[model samples]
Target chain A: GAGVSQTPSNKVTEKGKYVELRCDPISGHTALYWYRQSLGQGPEFLIYFQGTGAADDSGLPNDRFFAVRPEGSVSTLKIQRTERGDSAVYLCASSPTSFPQYFGPGTRLTVL
Target chain B: GIQVEQSPPDLILQEGANSTLRCNFSDSVNNLQWFHQNPWGQLINLFYIPSGTKQNGRLSATTVATERYSLLYISSSQTTDSGVYFCAVPRGSRLTFGEGTQLTVNP
Candidate 1:
């Protein structure tokens, strides 16, 4: 069975640029989550989606961060006007209803 | 928001030795999970024990919800176990993770 997977394992962008990270959840998973891991730090939650609607997004750092899962199986995390402070690894996870989450390999984003 | 704290912060163990990592939470939680992040930065789910105990191979975990703490035990450690161990709890639909315990097992 396929686990969660993220696209473009690595991404580099200049400050003030916009970038989008994609995630493909496991088959039949109805829950998707996004998190960010800074250097020497643990992963920080970002957003969560159940089905097509976002169930919780309180972890989003600021207005510049947004995510969507229109089809309920795939998700996209969008960042507006990238900042050097945003340089980190973005992780995606998926799980069945009330089950343990399975994580993806993550997409490392660098802002220069 | 809940506070999650991991003890020791770092540990160094010899292969075939046993070690235990602990995690403490500030409040009650509906979900608790343990994860292992390898040197390459890949996160692997180890256990999902909100309460009680569970074991897999050389790894075992016990969560005492009433005590607001969980312990992960690794027996007969191997060099491959060198990595970071994290404990997470759900806050709403998001997971709140601890800083993690860095483990280095030497051969």
Candidate 2:
């Protein structure tokens, strides 16, 4: 793809329901990242992947929040028992070898 | 964790005006970059300046790695330039973005 792509630009789910957000990064990006942004706040790191392995998952709020980049090209962020506080914009980004990252349009998930 | 802060959380400028936005980090960083998030929520990379100054036509950026700060300068602001500007730093494979400065350029 020409740029990073995220599915379900907007999502509205009932509390406690599980949801999965997907990301398709640039064709050859070696590093991928996921961020969460609340209204009026900057994006916060949720997880990072180097190839198919998750190099860091320290940013995940709790065990219920998980993400995986199985093939090194596409990634999925899974949330279990979603809470109303979980409502926010989920952002996915990718980078080749540099620190500069390219971001997706983001999925605005609303837990109601 | 790196503490990234940007000044003037909100900025309003008239078309053709010039302005500068500042970002400060609490810790040392190996790299820094700027991005412009449009109304549609697409983040577009603007600069990859860890140090020194780089200019791209009406826009320019300067980062003083030693001072742990960076500045983004917008010259001849246009209505289309109205958006949120974010500065992020390399924190391992992840980049920590600042709170972002929302710039509104009115024609």
Candidate 3:
């Protein structure tokens, strides 16, 4: 009955640095998704994984953003050479298939 | 990409009052969901009604898929209900969310 969980609830880093946000989905969930939310705005899709493979990653802003879920239950969103503009709350969600996504407490990333 | 629009960008209500939030999409969707983001910045799933109606306690949602709209009704709301309510529909394989309606419930 555990909901999704994210590590390092808050992270602060300098510009051009690298950071990784992890997500632990509910057991038996076969789909995972990543999203980013800026201040006073709705969350924007980042990437999604179905099982161990990323089913759709078009939402990833650029090549600097990459995510992986090799085992299908845990996924990590990695940012390379982070920019100040990349500062936001990174959210993760998991679902039985893709509808009714249950979200986790987002990891707020601050790029200073 | 489907466009989502929510009415009354902001709302103020007294605790124990009733209110309705609306969401309209530009295209038909097979999936529509409502979420509430609390002040602590946690996104909680409220409903996944793509059609018909569903209720959970004092909260209920109705989606008229053919009309491209959905409505969320809160009856006798509480102070804890104050937060940003969002409606999302899939755009491609990912969900596209609305600007969200910020609700303030005063006790």
Candidate 4:
């Protein structure tokens, strides 16, 4: 079985630019989540989607960060006017209903 | 928000040795899980024991939800076991993770 995966394993961009990270969850998964991990720290929650709707997005740092999981399988985390402070590894995970989560190899985003 | 803490922020072990990692939470949790982030930065799900115990090969985990803590034990560990081990608890619909215990297994 295929595990969760993310595209563009590494991305580098200038400050104030926009970037989008993609995630492909396992087939049949109904929940997706995004998180950010800074150096030497644990992952911080970003947003979550149950089905096609975002069930909880309180973890999103600000309005500049937005995510969508259309059709309940694929998700994209978008950052607008990115800042140097936003540089970190962006992780995605998926689960079935409310079970334990399986994580993907994160996309490392570097804002220069 | 529930606070999760892990002990021995860093550890070093020789291959074939045994070790135990611990996680403590500030509040009761309906969900608890352990994860291993390998050197390549891939997070692998290890266990989802909110209570009782579960084992996989040389790895086992026990969670005493009533006591708000969990323990992960590794027996006869191998070099491949070197990585960061994390424990997470649910907060709202998201998970709050611990800072993780960095393990280094020397062959």
- For all predictions, the C-alpha RMSD in Å is 0.9, 1.1, 0.9, 0.8
By the DockQ metric, which is better: model 2 or model 3?
A: 3
| Predicted structure with the largest DockQ when compared to the true one | 4
Candidate 4 clash total? Answer: 0
| Model 3 misplaced regions, further than 4 Å | none
Scoring each candidate complex against the real one, what DockQ results? 0.78, 0.84, 0.86, 0.87
Lowest summed lDDT window (length 10), candidate 2 chain B: B89-98
Could you arrange the candidates by TM-score from highest to lowest? 4, 3, 1, 2
Candidate 3 docking band? high
TM-score of chain B as predicted in candidate 2: 0.98
Model 2 TM-score? Answer: 0.97
Clashing pairs in 2: none
Question: What is the DockQ (computed on Cα atoms) for candidate 3?
Answer: 0.86
Candidate 1, residues B1-107, lDDT tens digits: the string is 79999987999999999999999999998779999999989999999998999999999999999999999999999999999999999877778899999999998
Candidate number with the higher lDDT (2 or 4): 4
Q: Flag clash pairs in model 4.
A: none
Q: Residue B20 error for model 3, in Å?
A: 0.7
**Which stretch of 10 consecutive residues in model 1 chain A shows the poorest summed lDDT?**
A94-103
Task: Give a tens-digit lDDT track for model 3, residues A1-112.
Answer: 9999998899999999999999999899998999999999999998889999998998899999999998888999999999999999999999997888889999999999
Instruction: Give the residue spans of candidate 1 off by over 4 A.
Output: none
Worst 10 residues of 3 chain A by lDDT: A93-102
Docking class of 2: high
lDDT of 4 at A81: 100
